[model samples]
Target: MSTMGNSTNIFWQESPIGKLERQKLLNQKGCVVWITGLSGSGKSTLACSLSRELYTRGKLSYILDGDNLRHGLNKDLGFKADDRTENIRRVGEVAKLFADTGLICIASLISPYRKDRDACRAMLPDANFIEARLLEDGLHEHVRQEIQKAFTSLHVLERLKIFSPYLDLISLHSRSYIQPGFTGIDDPYEPPLNCEIEIQQKDGDCPTPGAMAGEVVSYLEEKGWDVYQQASGSNM
Candidate 1:
């Protein structure tokens, strides 16, 4: 209703040097590697491993681990749903800024909701968003299977009755609700569909972590991200 409001316009300015300039100087393409999974999953492990591997290849990269960030950047936040959402939003903004500056940003967090991850993806370009899944495997799977088998060995009704007290305790609390297809509590994790890559828990033909790192590095190289060329271009 105010004529002055309609006359207001924002101004756009061009930077002397842009993202491509920084990317050229950094000798690598900037992107985001978002790792998601439950607690005790291998998100942090993979992020650290990838950072080391990239360093060995002379590619610049930074890893943002959950505990490391929460200790400072997000120390005041709690685990409430809204707090969780805001935490992820802030992380996404920071990661996008980092990527814009030509740094490969690897965020290892239990970003549970699909909505949160999607929000991150929207902030980054399609070519720059890489979703890495950390699956449960190795010793953890073996332990879980052994426990389940042991529990199954007992008579069904007897087993239920034995754990009835614990079930009663759980039933007494009703702080959260599970949506269909949801698999976890404390946070709800939605697996990525059509992801760029999926890391399996069972080590296959590869012998060690180095082999896995090599595979990832090779994949990134094949994607036309020539860090050396970019860096050289920046210098020229």
Candidate 2:
């Protein structure tokens, strides 16, 4: 048998630790990485890669993928607009918890509805949001070719920003899961006005996950996520 130490558990007590203390334990500053894209888009793929980089740097982080949530926290939800709203609402709440604990929360969801995403954004701090765009139109051979054609029409930079049409196709295919955009089904997503970082798509035949991860790390660092030293000035 084991004997208890000369310690007592109290039902309640005054606050003892602050978020800064937890942040110290976690090392790196915490934020939320909200990755939204069409099905077949690389939302989860990018999220996984991002998490790997965070782990490599000894940063505390976690990924909240949509499918996994449906199986657990949001198991009772369905595909109706209201249900989708509730789903995002719940996820946002959980993400907030992780962020509060000073852990980088990476959420990969279709999250096609802007209103839901906006609600989540409102719940988090201003500087804690990082948005990345992943073009899913590359899934189909014909569509990929179409994207290639569209790519040529504009400069290489614009080509990487081809998610507009890809999102349209996704909305069409997954109408049930998607709540029609408030402006229009084809409503465009307003780029993050003050996002700490934006991972734009890169050109070329090969994937550039490493470069993208480097950008995210750079943004985290720029935001004052220094695991080794305490924040002297302001929070990111």
Best by TM-score: 1
TM-score (all chains, Cα) for each model: 0.71, 0.66
Indicate the worst ten consecutive residues by lDDT in candidate 1. Answer: 174-183
Error of 2 at 6 (Å): 41
For model 2, the local distance difference test gives 0.68
TM-score of 1: 0.71
Worst 10 residues of 2 by lDDT: 177-186
**Per-residue alpha-carbon lDDT of candidate 1 for residues 117-183, written as tens digits (9 for 90 to 100):** 8898899988798877666556545654554444343335345665567554543331132222223
lDDT of 1: 0.70
Point to the candidate with the largest lDDT: 1
List candidate 1 segments past 4 Å from native.
Answer: 1-14, 142-186, 203-207, 227-236
The digit string of per-residue lDDT tens for model 2 on 1-236 reads 22444546534433677667888666566688888765555667778888888776667689999889999999999766788789989998898878888898998887767778889989987877666555443343455455445434443434567557876565454444334342112334343444455554456342577766666767677767653243343432
Q: Which parts of model 2 have CA positions greater than 4 angstroms off?
A: 1-15, 140-200, 204-206, 227-236
How does each model score on lDDT? 0.70, 0.68
Superposed Cα deviation of residue 187, candidate 2 (Å): 11
